[model samples]
Target: MDDVARLLKESWTLVEEHRDRLSGHFYARLFLLDPALRQLFPAEMTGQGDRILDAIVTAIQVVDDPESFEEYLRALGRDHRKYHVDAEHYATMGVALLDALRCTAGDGWNLTYDQAWRDAYGAISEKMLAGAAADGNPPFWHAEVLTHERYGQDTAVLTVRALQHPLPWRAGQYVSVEVPRHLPRVWRTYSVANAPNDDNVLEFHVRTPPGAGWVSGALVRRTKAGDLLRVAAPMGSMTVDRASERDILCVAGGVGLAPVKAMVEELTTWNRSRWVHVFYGARRAGDLYGLAGLRELMETHPWLSVTPACSEEPDFDGEHGDVSEVVARYGPWTNHDCYVSGSARMVRSTLRALAEDGVPPPHTRYDTFGDL
Candidate 1:
């Protein structure tokens, strides 16, 4: 397994830089092999190539760990059900992917590398097939937007209720959402901002900068109450461990507060002794829209405390500098079960700080958004 993982990683470098060409070749080959499969994908195909590459890269990174590898591939399989993928589709995809890799790598590709990927893809497809066969839930859920509240120019907080079927999700998991009316077949992931409940409602906090993210932009700027959305299966591992007695440390930046808020809300139900400290930050005071709700939660849950910070607004009456720096000033968080969610830069900085504080890697979990 180690040798296979090593070969896969080394071979990937030969074509990772030429991802666009590789993806183009892969898709072309796939269509040439079976024209019918092209109908499963979106017509635009703007960010579609990157999504497939990201999945492959992630699979490569976790291949050596059997538990995580199987779990991730299975979840990915369940998520791909939204595209109506089946066993034969996986086999065809593997063939196209291998051909593209070989063509992109050219002379750098080897028989060992080819064999490694073949074995790995076999395992991947098998696990994914098992996951798809085991799932009794629908490929996607139809959800009605119950409310939409804008925050500044680029952010919105919205709630939706799944229609006809229950969408079960853990506190820190995220699900792929597609706005069929705006950008059909284009799905973007958003963390569920609330815990599971009998009401079958879910909340999402979105921050879409100008000209970026088709799905996010539509959700934030164009979506309104009564609109319908397609919600896919949830996938993430940042949830709290109820059995662990350690104190909790949560650091959130920008719209990344969604999952942290959900975890805290879940903890509120049965927590009595554990202390959960949340450090929420944004570039300016105006962007810290979720701080008010966190503050309100603190009023009722004595064990919970939230510290809001603004990196760009010095006049605001709270901590200054990056949220990661604020967390470092409050550490040593080595004894706590730490969870960090934010932009890639913020999560990276906070993870570095936690590592510096001697926190064990196993004790920390993180979710990063925006091109990570």
Candidate 2:
């Protein structure tokens, strides 16, 4: 497995630079092998290739760790259920993938790389298939948009109610959403901004900055109450550990507050002794859309505290600096369970600060919004 992992990573460098071409080859070959499979994907292929490549990179990186690898592949498999994929589709994808890799790698490709990927893909498919098979819930749930509220120009807080069936999920997990009215078959993942409830309502915080994010932009600007959406199965591991008694430290940036807020809401329900500190940051005070809610929560819960930070606004009150910097000043967080979520750069910086504070890897959990 280690040798396979090594070969996969080493071979990846040869083709990673030509990722766009590689993805093109992959989809072209995929459709050539099984033209019918093409219907499962969106009509527009924009940004689609990056998603698969990211998954492949994740799988390759974790191949040596059986437990993590299995968990990831399983979650991936279950997530793909939304596409109505089957075992035969995985086999076809494997063939298309290997062909693309070989063609893209050119002279750098070797028999060892080929065999390694074959072994790895087989394991990946098996676990994913097993995960899909084990799940009893529907592949995707039909949801009705109950409310939508915009913040400024690019951000929105929306609530939706799952229709017909309950969509079970943990506080910190995310689900893939397809707004068929705006972008059919184009799905985007969003963290559930609120804890699970019997009412089957889920809140999502979406930020569609200027031109990016088709689904997010639609949800924020074009969507409204009464619109129907398809919500896929939830996947993530950032949920709170009920067994742990450690004080909690949560660092959130921008819309990354979704999961952190959800987890904090969950904590409020049963927490009595543990102290939970949240450091929420944005570029300016105006961008701290969720700060008001967090402050309200803090006032009602004696164990909860929130420190809002503004990175670019010099005159704004409260902590002024990067949120991670603010966190560093407050830490020695070695004894606390830390959860950090935000843009990739923010999460990386905060994680670095936590590490510098001597917090163990197992004591920290994180999610990055860049990939979403």
Q: Each candidate's root-mean-square deviation in Å?
A: 1.0, 1.2
TM of each candidate vs. truth: 0.98, 0.98
Q: List residue ranges in candidate 1 displaced over 4 A.
A: none
Which residue pairs in candidate 2 collide? none
lDDT value for model 1: 0.93
TM-score, prediction 2: 0.98
Q: 204-316 in candidate 1: lDDT tens per residue?
A: 99989856688998999899999999999999999999889999999999989999999998998889999999999998999999988999999999999899989999798
Query: Cα deviation of 17 in candidate 2 (Å)?
Result: 2.0
